[model samples]
Target: MKTALENVHDWNFEINYNTVTAVVEFSIHFVSTEQYPLLEYLLTNGTKSLLLLPDDWKLYEEHLSDNEYRYYLGGCIRAFDIDTLIEILSSNFPCIYSRLKKNSIDALLHHDQQAIHGPARLIGEPDRYRFLNCILNAKKQLKSS
Candidate 1:
């Protein structure tokens, strides 16, 4: 079996929030950094590559507070060098989640679907759901699940 880090490498993902079905479906493929500009930029920015969801790009711009957004960007740039997996909009970081006490992975999924008017993609699934759950809540996502 592949190590967690190894598994994360060969991934390209898509997310569909079925407005009609009121459901979500997400899938991943073995895509290289060539398939994503952010990944490419991370590699070129003196880091290997930072794995994050597509919707995160939007959240990076829409963080509930200016401090949160600034801190998030600073942290991500540093973490990217270490190959950390980030689900920014997912409010899935344990530290961020614990502070906010908004815990629920399912809710994070809802925000993802609603991002940009009904569908957003993660750079890839998080290494852990608990972490993502925290980030979503910290980001002020209102999804109940």
Candidate 2:
């Protein structure tokens, strides 16, 4: 049986910049079941550590009701700032981060969105390839132990 991470064919980082509020909203989308444990592992135990900060925890609490927060914690869906998004990518996927940092976050995200594969409507294959390679390498390391 394929692992949850293995089942993931593609994923994306979505950015929504509010010109009026000047807040850069971010989220992640991928092809995995909501019940996948890897999602929780990525949010809680991954190198990026999304919920580690008090402010982020408070923001989740304030913005989401109990059920919504549960889903967020489960990694079904999430909403956060650009900085958090940057931190997550930089820590977890440095190769992709290196490519993305050449331009402003808004411009980079827009460019990446335009680069998505038309048939799959997924993030650019180059980025996804690097991401999956990193993930598979990590999984290999864990298994070899």
> Each prediction's Cα lDDT score?
0.28, 0.33
Q: Note the residue pairs that clash in candidate 2.
A: none
Backbone clashes, each candidate: 17, 0
By how many angstroms RMSD does model 1 differ from the true structure? 19.2
Residue 34 displacement (Å), model 1:
20
How high is each candidate's TM-score?
Answer: 0.20, 0.28
Query: In model 2, which range of ten residues has the least summed lDDT?
Result: 68-77
Q: What TM-score quantifies how close candidate 2 is to the native fold?
A: 0.28
Runs of candidate 1 with Cα error greater than 4 angstroms are 1-10, 31-88, 92-145
Looking at model 2, residue 47 earns an lDDT score of: 48
Question: Cα miss at 31, model 1 (Å)?
Answer: 6.4
Give a tens-digit lDDT track for model 2, residues 1-145: 1122323334444334333433333344344332221122222114444432112332221123322221222121233433444454445332221122233456445554532211212234455455445444443553464
Candidate 1 worst ten-residue window by lDDT: 93-102
